[model samples]
Target: MNYKQIVQYGVLIFGAIILIGLVLKGNISHEKFDSEKWKNWTETESELSLRWDMMNSLRNNHELIGKTRTEIIELLGKPDSETKMDFRYYLGMSKHGINTGSLTIKFNENRIVTDFSVWQG
Candidate 1:
């Protein structure tokens, strides 16, 4: 074929490959959360943790709105850092790969979880 036709075909193929890659990445990022896997994922390197894969499931299935501090620790293990009002657990690399992500659980005066959020820094 002519040079113009060859170039057009190349561009189409490249675009299709990119679209497929995006679809696969999206699917991989939403893996179901498993408590056993989560507790055992103790990789020091944030990027290696299974927590990234399970994040969506944890947020959707687990109810952290009113759990006690003891319950939180029992479920999620010890936090990387904690304060009087909150605990932070490092999840893994952010979607952008420029920073790490963490789960922050907030508690009230009764030491019950009031809210929680996931963030990337």
Candidate 2:
């Protein structure tokens, strides 16, 4: 073969090798991302805001009675400890700082909330 033809073939082979190396280094594939699913996470921000508002309201007013168990969970997040005494179930919230108080809730036989109260610590 002529020198020119040999150089042309060498350049083509080198270009093919470089292209294959890049392809092997990174296996590019199509990925589908649903916009609706991405937008769904925004709802969590609203949920967190609602929880914060409820917590503020509960902190301002420490009254626990008349509020259902669901509302208590929403306001207090979760109890620190739960213990079952002979007749009633006790749910407790630990004392934080000087401004914060501990919360105690009592449940009846059917796991329904009968009474709840907050105490200063």
Best by lDDT: 1
Error of 2 at 116 (Å): 1.2
lDDT of candidate 2 over 15-81, digit per residue (tens): 9999998875433222232223322322243332222223334444555555555555554444556
Listing every candidate in turn, what is its Cα RMSD in Å to the true structure after a full C-alpha superposition?
6.1, 22.2
Highest TM-score: which candidate? Answer: 1
lDDT agreement with native, every candidate: 0.84, 0.45
- TM-score per prediction, in order, is 0.70, 0.32
lDDT of 2: 0.45
Question: Can you list the residue pairs that collide in candidate 1?
Answer: none
lDDT digits (tens) for residues 34-99 of candidate 1: 777777777665436478778878888989999999999888888889999999988876556556
Q: Which stretches of candidate 2 lie over 4 Å from their true place?
A: 1-56, 59-71, 85-100
lDDT of 1: 0.84
Clashes of 2: 0
Q: On a 0 to 1 TM-score scale, where does candidate 2 land against the true structure?
A: 0.32
